[model samples]
Target: MRTTRSRTVAALGVCSALVAGPLTAPAAADVADLRLDQWGLDTVGAAEVWEETRGSGVTVALLDTGVVTDHPDLDEVTVGPDLTGQDLSPDSDGYGVHGTMMAGIIAASGHGIEHTGGVMGVAPQAEILSIRVAAEADAAGGGETDPGALAAGIRHAVAEGVQVICIPLPDAAFSVQGDEAERDAVAHAVDNGVVVVASGGADGEAVYPAAYPGVLAVGSVGADGALSEFSSRGEHIALTAPGEEVTVLDADGGYTTVTGSDAAAAFTAGVAALIRAEYPQLQPEQVAEALTGGAVAPAAGAEQPGHGAGVLSAPGAMAAAGTTAESVPPFDPELAEQLADDPLVPRWVLWTGGAVLLVLLAVVGLVVLRRRSADPYGLGRRTPETERRPVRGRRRRGRGRRGVSR
Candidate 1:
């Protein structure tokens, strides 16, 4: 097992080294031309929602490795305390790369890296509070993230009055069932009216924090609007967003693309920030419902196990009501008896209804059989022959012209 893990790390190192080449700054006009390349933003209708709110006055707490405070895209980010005990600066190189990537996806301003059109987050005006819980190397070293640090980070974010908390790292990095302390911390944040969003895991298994109640578990979708093959599948998923080949700013101030549920979760958090900023009176649960209820349905024939409510629709959510409908009350025998006594229809009416349904079914079956006979393909239905015929258009070359030219 140790040897296998070492080989995996070595392979990943080589790939990273190959892709981490120096980047050149592009002209300012290049940024404008590449606006459509931010497919994630376009997918969620971020531009329409931006007309109302760009997540102004919202603070999103990112719990992960750490962030690059100096990254031009993250100049507005506030670096929080490092709980990893590495004595690493918030903008430390190497260890905080993953956290920095997630942060850029949530709040990057497309500043310095704009040459590659840089990266623009869903909520460019939102503030990021960087809370370092673990380093990127810990996972590569075959060690799990410190559960204690994760729990502490949540509590700290809540105390700091952050409106949204994003945990892009999966719970598997710590435990299968998850750390009890971390679950409690997430619950505490929710209770305090802070929306907690977490990755639904890259593997097809339930992960912590996201699996916990009151926390929105976000899955991933590809640019084609299909569920990402690697996104975890489960009932815990609350919503999905584009994650495949998502552009993010590295700690070294370079642009790169990443694929995973983590990117989806960060984008969801940005949408949550937009909601919080637009509707300050909404509760956490209400915000979750708006996002889920307003989601755009996935494309037909797409496997939907990993996609919860479907693709995140920022404009739809912003346009939705801030409150979810009240749950129906529990069954009451007394009310049932009272309703039973006041039947809207006589008992004989039910018998008539059954007979009518049977007749309707027989008529439908007869129609289907007649249509199938006329349709040579037995498609169970019929279409006009003219409609099935291919419409022909004028040929580019006439027969006489073609022969003479030949």
Candidate 2:
């Protein structure tokens, strides 16, 4: 099989961690061998998407691990940059395949690539913009871990005029640096009318870039339409996509889904490209609307894992975008109420009240303590004679009022 590029949500990871299945080989692809439809991939709907958009002139940027551009599935990844400083060659460690997997999901053309039987992408038509940010954390050995590299890569993608940006990698620090950088870049794109799709972390929460406002945070669903334990859940999730196990050449060189949300994120981004093409006049908000509006609610017993929106429905999204349906739904009342009742409150308001109360309490307590500390006696001073009282009459012996001792 031909080697190509890179490749979940939080719950999916948890499930994968718990699952112990024998490593299965990648699907030997023939149209008949394509299990995607059986897995509920909606290939017919994808064709409907191609019938309209064909992802023409659209570029989906993948910012994460390095992509193997030479993979047969990724022939359309003609333009990209190496943001990560590791080897871009095909024979790198198994970990470096993350980006390639993502690229495949967005746009791999692996029709004839040899030895590359199973790992096919969702969007084989869209062009991929690979901006590798972090170094290999896998078998390719490790490389530098710079948050700045990720920021710089985002800015560069914005400058490059890509239509859609997909970010699957997450930062462990949980600070706002990467989030701010990615958000700013996204805003820059929005000003130019670009759409961004991001994958939440495979652990517990939506990662930076995805967690930021304005960007669409996508989650994953298993074959049964249930939320994988690894699929992160929260209000941050804007939509869900299929994220079942796909055979990857794991660390043991055996095929199995070591992980897959990265693929889901890319797949969703590809769908975004389709919507963009069909409704070229729609703004970023409108595109987001089309996606969220079209998503199917999560499968039963798994609804909590959804963004309250449904799984990725590419056909539904395209159809929704083509129509003039009411774009964005009103905010959820429950969410609004919860936010309003938040006890933490705003920082400035909390600090202001705290400072005012602190000063007043300090002043009042100080006045009381000062009065106490300043007092020589509790109520009034006790005269020494009052205390000694001339030793109650025996004092006359020692002092004699000058000399009578007995």
Candidate 3:
């Protein structure tokens, strides 16, 4: 567990108020036991991904509660500044629980000989930069949710040259809006070729950074692959992943199950890492395309309201990365048509504009025809003097290359 602690810590406490899960210890588990519990890995085709690349050379920035660096399963993690100003100790109440859980989902390398025990991550070979952005909110709303700190954390991660940034907390978790510093920070990350993955929130509508453009907003899905009811629904959702009852590492170095879009975002971030590692030359938006292009639509042949492209497919994303091929965006035609009716220029306005253009063209054509009819030559506009003076030997045709006898 390595950390670069900040000299000045803010007094505002932080904890997980966005996700819902209770930390419960289980008996010592081996790799087999943990693997059995990780239904998400299989759902996202992580096994197939391991055969290609275990996400080597990819670093994911986890902006959430600080991580438990010493967790047996978490092999690669660098704890960054404690921006939340909460106690940095691992034993602090709910300090790093959520972040640790998210980290495990992203890149826990497992423990023991041959790495066969503990929680295995989607990108086991990937690295984690755990930045303590916030923690569970206290009962009295004492959790310090600083938008500026989050922005700083994002910029810090980008400056560190991380390949991906995972925000386990939704925009609603902290009060933020588009065009704020946080939004600009997100933009900066994207512009710098960093892929940003964020929770779409558990509530109905997406908020803030998740809803911001270029952020891959993730939703939650259960073992059955159906969208989780608790997962937020919005037009911004990029895709769904296993988040319901997903097994993760607790701060106490034990295994526990969590259910929320937070886990989904983490898992998606890991997928992005895998894509980045496999296709290093691909830009951030191209990596995002691979994710959406490789996703599978729902069984009903219709996109769920907020499921974006569909369920994520790890192998599919790898195959789709760095390609210029187009994939169908998950959208309901009926709904899209309804939305399309309200274009920036109303249908009536467009019709009027077209009519005016046609009228102008017709009037110009009429004037040209009248002019040509009045003057059988392609000379200047006809005048009484030119009409009266028919002294020319031979009139030139309509702008032809023939010489006019003057």
Tens digits of per-residue lDDT, candidate 2, 1-406, equal 1133222122222224336452223223232243343253353246556656667667787786766644433566644566556545445554345666566566654332242333344555677777877654443324334556666776777788777888766333233335556567667777777787877655455567667767788777777777766777666777777666643322222123434455567668888888765556677888888888887766576447544477788888887787743453433435666787874477789889999999999999989888888784777666876685443444434434654556
**How many clashes (backbone N, Cα, C below 3 Å) per candidate?**
1, 39, 8
What would the per-residue lDDT of candidate 3 be over residues 139-207, giving only the tens digit for each residue?
Answer: 223444578778999999998989999998833363435647888899999999899999887666657
Q: What's each prediction's TM-score?
A: 0.70, 0.63, 0.70
- The local lDDT score (0 to 100) that residue 117 gets in candidate 1 is 40
Clashes of 1: 1
| RMSD after Cα superposition, model 1 | 28.3
lDDT of each: 0.76, 0.61, 0.77
RMSD of each: 28.3, 18.7, 17.8
Pairs clashing within candidate 1:
26-115
